[model samples]
Target: MSRELRLAEVFVELADTLVDDFDVLDLLHTLCERSVELLRADAAGLILADQHDVLQVMASTTEEARVLELFAVQNEEGPCLDCYSTGEQMANINLDEVQQRWPRFHIATAEFGYRSTHALPLRLRGQVIGVLNLFCAEHAVLSDADVKLGQALCDIATVGLLHERVVRQGEVLAEQLQGALNSRVLLEQAKGIQSERAGIGVDEAFTLMRAYARRTNQPLRTVAEAVIDGSIAADELKRPR
Candidate 1:
């Protein structure tokens, strides 16, 4: 198949993975494989940044590629870091011509036989999330068309990842809401138990529960769950230990 058709197929496949139970690892694995195939890169890898701004190797086309990418980060040099830091596309970086720019990165990747590298930032609007790295073993310089196509793929992937994150956050928000409701339910039940056992009002019961949890260094939720489940002796509540 032609490159355009292949890329279209990849987009379709990627879209199919966006269902409710999509596997994130599988999606990233496919992205790296498709980049290698459609971009004609010798190897490709994806680096994802966490909330802490720490970049981690998320997926790669080859183990050697993965090692080289990590070396790029550890050495604090190379196109990936440069692209990420600047939130710009970096391409056709010839290691031979610019060895001085990244001595350790050039040496480490050169040992693995990669002669050229490119990195594209995965960004949405002003927020740059990560980088897509492509390496060549044959000192290849990307043509204008190659650069455009590679950047397009990276942009698509960044949009997809960002959409997935928004969906995940929605799910997390729903879960948190459910958790809060569950906690409220358990607290009510615990209050009832304490009130009946201690001949106290619900407010007094809650205050006693909170005080005990704070004194014991246990979470209020844990104490409430225990009270509701009858694991905590009712007599234990009276003594405030």
Candidate 2:
């Protein structure tokens, strides 16, 4: 798929996961995975600042990315760190050319086998959370469109993460989301129970449960919880009169 299409699909997938309680790490992990295919980079990584302003590797496509990021941190240089510090992208950079920009980092990262690099800040409304790092074995300038696309993807992920952090609404929404996730676990258990009892497939049992929920105007999670808690009589599923 084109990067744009893949990005659209990514957002759709994320929207699907936004039910009640969502996992931030899961979404961030997805973002890093998609960036590799979307940008066609040899490797990619996500770096975020902790409470102490220390740059930590949140995710990476390869062991090399992890090592290079560590090299950057230790050397106190490299595109990702510069991008994060300036809140500006550092794109299509040849380590050999800008040897002065990050001398020690350039030497170390190139030694690790990456030739060209691009770093886009994960910025929201002027505040930078971290950077999205892309590295390629071939030394070439990243197309303007590709960099823009990278920034856009990072922006979408940043908003989604920050939304989760803020939407708790006195932490009620957070609790509700957690409850929904817990309810999903119950639904899984109920599906297994119904599958064994009715000699139906697990998927079929889920469909029946969803159909029941839709017909009764109750949420899927609520229906699942009811089934698991014995609040809904099992025999009730067979009666119409």
Candidate 3:
């Protein structure tokens, strides 16, 4: 498919999420998957700032610790953090030369054998909702066109992911009636439970839960309930192979 056609189809897929089967996790997964396909990247991941303004791994194509760790390193410093903070794109970064800037992220990506990365802030209009990180295998570099395409994908997808079908009543609490907000709350709780029980950080816990949800073809909240109820053992949801 032409890139334009593929991007149009991706928007359609995102619109399908607002129906009764709205699954935020799946929407994010689609964003990452389409990013890799359209941008010619090895893998992609999304980091969403939750209600608390803390960045969390919302979705990723791979669950490898090395790969997840690459995202985690951004919690302190990296292209993703900078892109998100500035609401700007950080494109075609040569990992070797960034040793002084993002030392840990640089060393970690090098150790994983990935040499370049591009990060785009998930901004729409004037609001930056999240960040998208694209990892290129080998000593790969993205063209100026590729960088623009990546940012376009991020901006377009942000609309669907945050479309806020919030229902309001003069007598009702807004958060109670907002499905998207409710989902975010459950996501945070699940992360905390998994982290506490499994002895891992919230980011790693989310990775494990997200990996398990994808592996079993289940909705994120269903899998989260299982984890909370002890139905899905944390050990069973181990990092993806």
| Highest-scoring model, lDDT | 1
**Candidate No. with top TM-score:** 3
TM-score of each: 0.67, 0.65, 0.70
The C-alpha lDDT values of all candidates are 0.73, 0.71, 0.72
Residue 97, candidate 3: C-alpha displacement in angstroms:
2.7
RMSD of 1: 17.5
Model 3 clashes, total count: 0
Model 1, 66-148: lDDT tens digits are 78878877777787998899998888898875487888888888888988888888787877878889888888888888787
| Candidate 2 Cα errors over 4 Å, as ranges | 1-4, 14-20, 164-241
> RMSD (Cα, Å) of candidate 2?
10.9
CA displacement after TM-score superposition, residue 207 of candidate 1 (Å):
57
The whole-model C-alpha lDDT of candidate 1 against the native structure comes to 0.73
Query: Taking the tens digit of each residue's C-alpha lDDT, what string does model 3 give over 1-241?
Result: 7867877887677667655455766677778888888878887878777656666666677654225534564457788888878998888888766677888777777776677888889887777777888888866678888788777777667765555553222322223224444565677688788898889988779778877887877888888888888887778888465
Query: Quick one: how many clashes does candidate 2 have?
Result: 2
Clashing residue pairs in candidate 1 are none
> What would the TM-score be for candidate 2 when compared with the true structure?
0.65
The CA lDDT at 123 in model 3 is 81
Q: Which regions in candidate 3 have their CA more than 4 angstroms from the true location? A: 1-4, 65-75, 164-218, 227-241
Write candidate 2's Cα lDDT for 1-241 as tens digits. 6755867787686555454445444455467767777778888877777655667665566657767877777667888888999999988888776587888877777787888888899888897878888888888677888788778878887776556555555564334334434554576688777677777766567667766775786766677777777777666654453
